[model samples]
Target: MNGRFVRLGETGRARVAIVIDGQAVDALEGDTLITAMLCSVRHVRQSEFGEEKRAGYCLMGACQDCWVWTDEGERLRACTTVVEPGMRILTTQPEAQWATLAL
Candidate 1:
């Protein structure tokens, strides 16, 4: 588990489980997707253009840097999305279709 942000004497906050890259991670009920990842995930996504890594920037969802994907090929901004129970998320870009690949 990654480091937590809990304050001393804090208690009774509900937890919601979200699957990131096939791994289950716990997030507080009121947490935004970025906040959920910040509580446990070390990195959010890999840059598609290069090998650089990404976490999050502009917590208000203006930068568009913290996007994650779902199994159904839908993408959502992590910074503004809220955590929901049994939600499946993928930090990496989904596999490209064979027809989309160059010969």
Candidate 2:
């Protein structure tokens, strides 16, 4: 066995690819958009103040870094959302509606 390498288990595996910014991005099969996205590069999570690139932590649903949009014109949390074949996702501003937060 190579001392510099170790095999990955099923749990270590990730998604293959996803569409973002009008492009198909590579990722693990099970990775969230946040994980799958920034894996290739930073900036998946845009800084609140500027355009500096950022990445996500706690791949779980704790952090809100995985927010995105679906081809259906619906907003969703990337960490909580699973990949569906040909399903479009948008990782930008969520549709703001007054009725949703009036309570």
* TM-score of each prediction: 0.82, 0.56
Per-residue lDDT of model 1, residues 1-103, tens digit only: 5733443433368988889878898888878888888777777787777777788778898998998888676898999999899988887777643235654
The lowest-lDDT stretch of 10 consecutive residues in candidate 2 is 1-10
Q: Give candidate 1's total backbone clashes.
A: 0
- Report residue 92 deviation for candidate 1 (angstroms): 0.9
Candidate 2 CA-lDDT value = 0.55
Please identify model 1 stretches exceeding 4 Å from their true place: 3-11, 96-103
| lDDT of each candidate versus the true structure | 0.78, 0.55
